[model samples]
Target: MDTSNEPHIAHKSHLPHPYDQDISHVLRHLSRITATGRKKLANSLSTAGYLAAGMWLIERNLGPDAARSACASGSRRSLERPLLGFLSQRAVAAAVAENPPPFPSRGGVPRLRTTWRSQSDFIADLINFAMWPTNYHPGYLEQRAVTTKRLVVGEDFVRAVHETAYLHTAESVRMPSVRLSLALMVLADGDDRVQRVLTDTYRGYLSSWKQVYAEVLRARGLRLRAGLGLDDLANALSAATDGVILRSIGDPHAGVVDRGRERTLMGTVALAVMHGFLEPAEDSDGLTLEQAVHARLGRPRPSGATRSDALRGERNPNP
Candidate 1:
């Protein structure tokens, strides 16, 4: 039978031409996923490959090859089953790549037990981790990365704080859009797994701030105020940062900082609010927190106070 004009014949003719478009689509999608995500997708592909092997066997025995002549028939039968299997596996790979799974831990949330060198060091590390591009993947996996990152980010934010006051002139703020957006979606969708991870992440992050604040107070020989705690300060800082990140992502002109004043103004205002709550530690020329506070508040200096007395809260009687 003549099959020259047949659809199957036409399809077989084009088979040797290569499906560049389909290959490009898969490559493009893979590029958007993280290295970790790609690993997960590769595992999925392995599983799908096994399944496809079984289907290929069944196709060889009883598929449409029986209806055509040997020349046209064998080619279609040899190619069609594997092609279908490949496409199916590709689809599965794409899905897995886009949504990599979270890591499982027996413990509640991982915490960093080591001490930070200083508050500045702690803040710098936190900023670097949070602002990194690696943590910005748009998936549950991204949330997991943040959860782990926060274990090190150590937590706490506040709006009525002066920390954000310096943020007005800050040049660039990094917002991990993919991770933050996933967090928002997880919270909205009520994904309990991601939510639990996020909670643990925050806890670990807040704990670090407590340590930082304690060290800061100790260096100045000052006590925490009766009504305040390290956790409170950390909470305020965290809130301010989250707010700024959200605002930055929502604004249409958020990336216009270089060429446009309006966008720069918007960024300044957002960053200012963030900075007010996250007051970076100041180097106060060898003064203690008590002395600094007293000076700022216009109170009389403690009688016979030395630098040691200022740091120790009271003069050493032996000296």
Candidate 2:
């Protein structure tokens, strides 16, 4: 099979000696097992247990020689580096596979409308799509922000931002790929190579989201207040999102909700951040912030958009 187009977990030079092919075989087998579901496994397994399970499966299929080679002469540590990469790659692949072609609209949240010019750019988009929330359909925000002649800079814009934050927090709490990502994060802490990959992944994730937020602001003729910039809002929201996800992981009911109201923890933090940063653009047709927000909330949602619908074309919203 021509794997030239397939995403690799690591560079050729970074793979462990003599075990790279073996690792690939092992991963393929693991994928098959997960897909077939012929055998049952424990629902809760520690990271170490997960690793052990992989090794056991590999040994079972390829025999003790493969397992012994991986453990010999500090090769086990080397082997682990690619495993972390595999997890990250798998998360990305699973996300992409779930949300296939026709860019943007098939998935609940649109795939980025931008085309990637390089492998790095493409990988970054895959990672971004994997992490995006999926409560709203494609063109949901766009339909609201852009009117017949011009972009509407009012309540719809504010509500769109708030909805994005709320859905991101809500979906991330239950996303399976997020669990794998969290595990990968903990495992990458001491490994320099894996840490580099993780750092790059997150940088790309942040950059993609920054662009989305910036585009949304541009579409609605909004700007950051005073000294604030797009980067500030993106970074703040990113940090808050991380904190919320972590808190929600530990306490299932924590960050996903805000006092049982219609808002979310992330929504509150996002709005607070926006309050300090977002403002009407000078060209917003003389619409003040208060007037824009107080505009009626009765406008009908765009066609095919729904708050309760399942994410079409994907298994999980946040991958």
Candidate 3:
């Protein structure tokens, strides 16, 4: 792939001339996914999201060959088995757009950046802390040499590290394609603690694009004490997910309890579907995900709200 043709932002839609054509191929692929497919996309997301993300680290820092080798590890094998949930999330987003009553538009979902951000580093800190209950991943882990000229950390771990980020940009930035990447990583073993924290902490965020998930709040750099309001357009989905969890505790397929990594990834796609994180449709409303995100920015978060927070400390609050 030509780096020159790559869209600058993951899940991005806007592009300069000529390069725009490459984006079109991807966007068109997204538009074709069906409602059932979206549902599957959501459910299929798992460790793969993080694993694929790790690949991004290689692409940007280590070169593609090293990244491919990492994918063949025991970690990568784990993600392969649980892809349906991730796919479900993708299906749901597309389905939601099919319904116009709640959303403003239904076309042109935006692109997502595959690489984990500095916020990823923060989550990793928390994860490493949680894993040992009182330890870090060692500076060496974060500073591993991926290439002669570049150093690498678990930057891609953020993809499966939490669904909070996906929920953060859900309504305005639907990108189920990346959810496939997330599932792949979740299957891999980049960071297990990150998975646990997100599952336990952000349960309610899975509801809809409206209410803020607690973990995502923390991820966005909001202090635990800060108060965040719900998005009016998305409150219903939030409640719905909450209801399913409550009712699903005893059901066989939907209610059965999952253990270990399976336990944390449980209901991931189900919630994504309820929340509206699917791809966009053509000729629907021309509402690209980028527009939704831009519209979200137009409406201010609380006065104390901050955007794009980076991790600074290595202390694990959970520890």
Candidate 4:
């Protein structure tokens, strides 16, 4: 764990915390989960969407150092075409391999080949469609807002975040937090570039959870205690996730790699923290420790790179 090239937090100002007066109304996304099944469905979609995109990039040999160079403020946009071409080729190759078509007859008239679209566009559109409503009719929007208030401070928000962490650390890919830690090691101490990236990425990454927590508090007819707010909670959670991830990687037998232990632990901590800020709601999603263990162990472990094997850039077992 030589962290010489990684970034470290020397101070808070370089990575300023997100500060907003109130929760934004964007939590309309999570509001759609009225039933237990729907919540699970939404969470699954979110998990697959993020993991797939990350694996696709990593399989293409992208690494943190490469991402940092490409993600430079002005250079990211220039990568669209090349990245798209590569993705298109991979897509076509996969399609051909999985569902081979008959070759065209030499005597037949030439058929036009479809042009390749950027894989990034495909992913962006997929995520956008999944997140936002397709129809903006007044009636639909109104109904949406009504459904959005279902779980402001209960287990739904916590579960979504928990599932995301589970998926990121699944056996199929290298643990993302480990990757981030290594990435930070490569940066100069307190470098503005690293700080900017951390702040912007964390702000965007945790925005949904923050909004959900705010809505939950409002629904519970409560507000955060003095000196504690949604932003503070979010930053704390981020730190916790990072800390636990580092620990798990460094010590796999510490119960983190023990099926649902990690997810359950984080979820419990979140619920406890919420209770500290607001009154406990009667309708909390009662995810008992036994249930968490059952659910976690029931699923087949994801196959591919596990442990630190993927860190060395060996062949990825996942597509």
In model 4, what are the clashing residue pairs, if there are any?
5-185, 5-186, 6-184, 6-185, 6-186, 7-184, 7-185, 152-216
Q: Between 1 and 2, whose TM-score is larger?
A: 2
Per-residue lDDT tens digits for candidate 1, residues 53-124, read 322322232232312233446664443323222223333233323322121111110111111222222222
Model 1 regions lying over 4 Å from their true place? 1-92, 95-178, 185-189, 252-319
TM-score rank order: 2, 4, 1, 3
Count of clashing residue pairs in every prediction: 22, 1, 73, 8
Candidate 4 C-alpha lDDT tens digits along 1-319: 1112213422212221110111122112232335553334323322222223333443343332334335435675545324323334354334222321121111100110111133332332222322232212235445434334445434576565455445433321243333433344444245544444445445775796688667766666656544556787777776666665666655666766347553534545556665554444454323333333333453454486443343222223354
lDDT of 3: 0.30
Query: On a 0 to 100 scale, what is the lDDT of residue 84 in model 3?
Result: 34
lDDT of 2: 0.44
Off by more than 4 A, model 2: 2-155, 258-263, 283-319
What CA RMSD would you report for each candidate?
Answer: 21.0, 20.1, 25.1, 23.3
Best-matching candidate per TM-score: 2
Quick one: best lDDT, which candidate? 2
Q: Model 4, which residues run further than 4 Å from truth?
A: 1-178, 185-190, 260-262, 280-319
Task: Find the number of clashing residue pairs for candidate 2.
Answer: 1
